[model samples]
Target: MPNLNNVSSPSLWQRIWQGFLTTVGTKQFFRIFAPWVKWLAILASIFLVIGSVWGLAFAPPDYLQGNSYRIIFIHVPAASLAISIYFALAVLGVIFLVWKIKTASLVAQALAPLGFLLCVISLITGSIWAKPTWGTYWVWDARLTSMLILAFLYAGVMALFAAFEHTANRGKAAAILSIVGAVNLPIIKYSVQWWNTLHQGSTFTLTAAPKMSADMWMPLLLMVVGSYLLVATLAIYRTNTLILYRDQGKAWVKEYIRGQNK
Candidate 1:
């Protein structure tokens, strides 16, 4: 068998670390905040925070749902992103499974936790939103039910990936399930729309919109942007850590380890 532990004579580790950092290190992160990605996340977050706080605190209560509507800002973004993450995870999962591309699997692993976080936030916020709106904290409503399924699926994905003592089967299994879950998200999203259901219509859709004025929506949009950046930036950072873990004993790792010694 070929020697897998192929450490080079001197500085191979330094070369690899530089290459790894090339895609998304601190410099790239600054670009996202100030130059690239339009810094849209930060800008949008400002508007969102202002809009959410003002609307939640000082805006007039809905004549119908009353103060409970305040939860929409939190619930809507969480719900939207939870679904979005499934699609992303599925695509990345498929790539990882097909290519066995080390980077892709690392990314999928990094993103699993974020997906779960969004799902949990969506569930908790949905429950809170429902309490005043539906007169109960728990419901078998279509939207709630589907969203719960999403959260569980995310957990399953995470669990599969983290079953690393069984690494070979774990990666393959997680990737397949993530892709399968992605296919189900749209089905879940549209279930309420297609059938008569207790869950409310979508907030930003043409037929259904927020029952609020412009002052109310501006911040909600901002929050959505901020949430996306937060997830993405965190994912990238986590992926870096995972790559290091996976590659720790490589020639590159040894060379870099030596460089730090000098």
Candidate 2:
């Protein structure tokens, strides 16, 4: 008879190790992220091609801003993803902190740089948009101010992680910061409502129906989804790479890499 608790078989950690070994042998990291990444890439390409052709060649120019308003396709999606991806990172950060799962922590770290990049793009594009629409290059109103704060939060998290010497400690500290910042995200989202501001309310914001037509909005949606997939793929692949590097010299990890090579 099998002993109940006295003599157990392979533990959960052992199972995880074995799975890692098997997956590496098959080059499963790319295999796992590939399909989704490919889809995102394809959709993004299609959207850019179609949106550019339509916006440039077919669709009517903006009634208010005329040709300049065409920037919305790229600018809107970038701003949306900037906020969305950081929130997702914070969720993953929470999982990492609570479970002490190395993979989860690695993902949070890898994605931070990408999120920062998005935040930068959003701010730049928003500035360009604001120049014609708001008659200025920048504003200090609620939405704009809050988004600036969000970008700084991303920088702070990256700085915090880098400031630490030990990898494990860095992960824990970053996770804590992410969780705290995540709580502030909602406040940022609602700041326009909370206070009167110069920045125009969100065009694609969740609170109201989209003001643009299908022709204008469809490509924006495509870009948003495509950007999300691209980020997720980058995060997973980078995290896996980090795991392999960190695990180097360990017996199981060596075996896992060897299997991947084969």
Candidate 3:
């Protein structure tokens, strides 16, 4: 007879942990999400096109900055996405370190290049906007300086991952660097408020309405949402490719590849 009295069931937390691992750690997870990538790209294209056309051509120009302000459609979205992607990297670092989720690490690594590109876009567009608005192409403003540091952090994380030969070690090193670099996020967010800088405060915030009129902000909003979707599509597509490459030798990967080739 079994000693039923001594039997213990898994705790709720344990069940949830296992569920998360199964859902995210499996290659099938990517397959389930694969269809969304195309839809996301389509939606992103629609929003960006509408937003860009409205912003660049139809929307009323700023009273002071005029058409130069239209660049915000690109600059704001890129900057926002750069910051958001770093925040995601930080979250992925935590997941990888705490749960040892390989998917989280892979996704984090996949996002680094995109994050770096977005950061560069933000900086370049900002400088272009600055030359007309601030009378200089470069400044040592806190916002700009902190954003530059973010770009370096992204580069460093990518380099750290590549520096290691062992997969586990590479993930660990990159995760740790990402976690450490997350401290810079707050500094970047509050830099304008914390110091008297040449840069202005955030254009959008949850607690307050936008300072700009609807025609100006509406298209900007569309661009922001489109940019987010575009980034998400790229991230998922890249992560899926990474997963397939990493599991190239596995039976499931081989089967998937064979099917795709057909």
Candidate 4:
């Protein structure tokens, strides 16, 4: 209460932006984030274990599909992560292209493999779910086809990064491909609604109440949240590894390695 009015307060967005800039400005950014990433990974692991166990053993089985429906706990989360991570890659791509942020490019490179893995998991799980529900494992449906295209896009980005020898050139090519591939995200999201596909509409939406009951959705929500954190932790870990090698000549990195060895 003592002259509090004299103190300046930053807005929420300003504080967030400043925090981001502070992280990006530091040479020891990985060291600063390593503990946080460790914690995030631990939290993700706990939630993932809880969610998977709950969904597999305790969630009520679908009246129509029985226990087979439990796979949604994995498939939905994988699919959601696949799309969400690509969107993240696109954002990183923009940052790299516009600002030439080396960290952003490194992070995008780190995320490519993880994104592709999640996409593969989504496709395989979807196909497994399909055989029991629709009597076929593969279909040329819009949603399915679009998701396949997404996988190819991920592969393409990874390939482009490797195809170039110059680091800047590699980043530019990968960033361009990532930005262009972002169009596929909307296509994947809307394919079920856009066409007469066998794929089911979303069980949840921003504007509508969840189509699923709480017992069915609670674990799904947990899985989705946990998967996001898991991917983020992995991406950060990968980026830190890459940065250590890329910035090996930097004094801080050498000091960090020396400390680790000690």
Candidate 5:
């Protein structure tokens, strides 16, 4: 008896939008989906191992830089992830500030150290590569300087968050700091072009073919994708632990603990 002909099925984009809506607002979606994060971590680990091996061994040496260029596998991905994670942190800050989502703040808090670590890795790797490429260990180059500032920004966020004892106060202060820190991200991205920096121009872009040969760029791409996955895995793992800490007293968490104990 139902008018089936008039009932239109949801489009693919509509389903995706609905799913995204469901995942925000309340923390329930994250709580329910947290267990799957470990599987993602496992998968990311596989990708990282494969990509690292392919890059360090199988990929061809650069025509100019030779083996020194191999460090690109690590440095490029780390730098990219460092900036991407900060953007994610800023977005999370906005979410917490606007929506009063405690989980968003907690996730951003957890992300700070990871982002800092990646930024540090990027800087260190860049320095190591520079010794051979640029004849110097360090320089006050625009890109390098901006990236260093980004690392300090990450540290500032962490320190500012810890400085406040109250949860709400800490969240508010950190969120504002994070949003403000986002201004540095673009500065980092465009620094090489904006200023006559020692750093090289971008090797890859979204629209054009890679400047390098396929044999060289393919492994780099794999490394980039793997690093993104690795970052996601780390974020999800940290978020899960933070959620447990924040909700340890809640009934669902209690039930989860009991279930784990069993």
Candidate 6:
């Protein structure tokens, strides 16, 4: 046989693609992120406590809604996170489908429950806020209806994943559902504007200054940041645990277990 030592190395794009896969495709990805989870949790707690106190106790009440509007501190962040998490799931779906990254599917699986919880929180809090503001606990308004649909989409994705016994099939089904469900996001986002709805337009926007004063918006900002950090902490920690459980039969996982026991 001819000597094969002179074979050409991988092209630059191939090398880059392989490097990307190596970074996110294995347990090493969890190893890199696991250490940050504790710190993220700590920071999340601190921000949430500070933000809650500031918004509830110190922030000036809305001139119109009075103290009742304070619920936005909780409601807005949860709603924002619910949508953001679903968007992330959609992106992960694309990643898994395109690259066949097992870790992306794992992370998506870890995030779905948290997203569903946030969606529920948003709906409950919005309903409570609505009773005072809209004189009803619920409505068929576009934004509200769209949000409710989002909650159902989250449920459907979870159910689809659980329905399948084969790992690859489960991931693929859930991912396809997630991707298809993303069509609802824009509808939810534009519902208030598209129809005459009880739901108000966005209070915060990148293109313009906040409609509210500094004292009002500051705590809301803090709360939003805290909520994101909290989600990150939970998602990363959950993903790491999942990685361990799924890879338990592998050599690296066995070594990790041995090290922990030691």
RMSD of each: 9.0, 5.1, 1.6, 4.6, 4.0, 2.6
Which residue runs does candidate 4 get wrong by more than 4 Å? 1-19, 25-28
Candidate 3 vs candidate 4: which has greater lDDT? 3
* Model 6 CA deviation exceeding 4 Å by range: 1-16, 165-167
Q: Tell me each candidate's TM-score.
A: 0.76, 0.79, 0.95, 0.91, 0.89, 0.93
Candidate rank order under TM-score: 3, 6, 4, 5, 2, 1
Error of 2 at 192 (Å): 2.1
Q: Model 4: per-residue lDDT, tens digit, 1-262?
A: 5899988899999999888877773365686777878799999999899899888999999989999998899999999989988998999999989977778888888999999999999999999999999999999999889899999999999998888746548688889999999999999999887888899999787798998889888888888889998988999899888888778898998898899999
Q: Give the top-scoring candidate (TM-score).
A: 3
Candidate order (lDDT): 6, 3, 4, 5, 2, 1
Highest lDDT among the candidates is held by which one?
Answer: 6
In model 1, pairs of residues that clash are: 13-252, 48-219
Candidate number that wins on TM-score, 3 or 5:
3
Q: All models: lDDT?
A: 0.73, 0.73, 0.91, 0.89, 0.86, 0.92
Query: Please, what are the lDDT tens digits per residue for candidate 6 over residues 82-175?
Result: 9999999999999999978889988999999999999999999999999999999999999989899999999988888788735558688889
Q: Ten-residue segment with the worst summed lDDT in candidate 2?
A: 22-31
Which runs of model 3 end up more than 4 angstroms from their true locations?
A: 1-14, 165-167
Model 4 earns a TM-score of 0.91
TM-score of 5: 0.89
lDDT of 2: 0.73
On residues 1-262, what C-alpha lDDT tens digit does candidate 1 reach at each position?
Answer: 8876895554888789676556443333333332433454455556567766776777676778777777877887888888888888888787777755556666788888888898898889888877777788897877778888888899998888877635566577788889887767876789888778778777675576665676666666666766776676667667656655666777665665687699
What shift in Å separates residue 146 of candidate 4 from its native position after superposition?
0.6
Clashes of each: 2, 3, 0, 0, 0, 0
Query: What would the per-residue lDDT of candidate 5 be over residues 169-236, giving only the tens digit for each residue?
Result: 87788789889999999899888878898999888989888999988888888888888887777787
Winner on TM-score (3 vs 4): 3
Worst 10 residues of 5 by lDDT: 24-33
